[model samples]
Target: MFISISIPLADETRVRPYTIASSPEDGDLFEIVFNRVPGGAGVAWLFERKAGDEINFTGPFGAFTLERAPERELVFIAEGTAIAPIRPMLRRVFEQKPGHPVRLLYAADRVEHLLFRGEIEGHAIAHPQFQFETIIADGGQEALYARIMAEVERRWVVTDNDRMRHFYVCGIGAGVLRIRDLLRGAGYERRAVRYEQW
Candidate 1:
């Protein structure tokens, strides 16, 4: 899910979208994660806001959520801040469908870029059915995509139930496209692999 925040600038309004980071189970409060981009007007306005300041926005938008395939294995692939939506999906799965097998294959240029690492690790420790893997590719997006493809090939492409798995991918356009194509080429149905490009 995401929210489009309207920021009022000197002459006009600028809108920016951010993924909702908190779980719906967290009553009354929602969280958004973002990196402070230099010279970004929307982020700059957001950063200057004080407590109790009113902000205009609209949301809970986007179809990036957990599928209703309770029997299918869940494979979530996220990179950098793209993990925002995946975090809540994982929480929902553990809360409502704990028996389903879930795997998270996350990548970033650096370890510090991996969001919610601790929480995800906690879930892995608590749920035997949950698996988490991290890939740090300092060489850039191309290297990241290569490593992710390698991991996917190792974990799912060779499995007998390869087509029975549900994949959720979110990341840069090139990376997301590469993974989606790999899955599709491996004979998985298009619907079985959902993706969002950042």
Candidate 2:
């Protein structure tokens, strides 16, 4: 789910949607992850907030969530800050559906841009059912998608009866669309792939 925070600028109020990175099990405390975009008012406003400052938001919005398909293997593809939502989903899967096999293919422009890297790696080490891979796409989104597609082709064998796999992809609009289309072209059904694009 996401929260819409309104930032009051000198001219107008700008609303930005941020996915909650913390798990529901975390109780009263929650977290969000974002990178500061140059000249972006929403992130600028958020970055300027100090302790004791109060910010108003409305949410628990968006239907982009994990499907109740414990029998299916889960594959998550996330780029950049899109990993925010996937973090909680990973927690849910590991906690509630430990038997389900999961693979996370995460990409970032640089190694430093890979969020939660150590934590995700730890998950891989701890859970045999979980696998993680990271791609450094210095050549931008196209490079990221290309590397992801190559990995998918090499690692997964899509077949007519491959109904036991579910894909969750999140990224910028173009990259998300490209990956979704690639999956579809590889003979996966529309319902088998769930995506959130911004």
The lDDT per prediction is 0.87, 0.84
lDDT of 1 by residue, 80-112 (tens): 989998988888888875667889999998999
lDDT of 2 by residue, 1-198 (tens): 999998888898998899999888899878998778768887998999998899889997998887353577899999889999898888778877566789999988899998999999988988898989888878966888788777776666443446557899988758788788877777777888889997
Clashing pairs in 2: none
In model 2, the Cα lDDT at residue 110 comes to: 90
Model 1 root-mean-square deviation: 2.1
Root-mean-square deviation per candidate: 2.1, 2.1
Q: What lDDT is reached at residue 76 by model 1?
A: 94
Candidate maximizing TM-score: 2
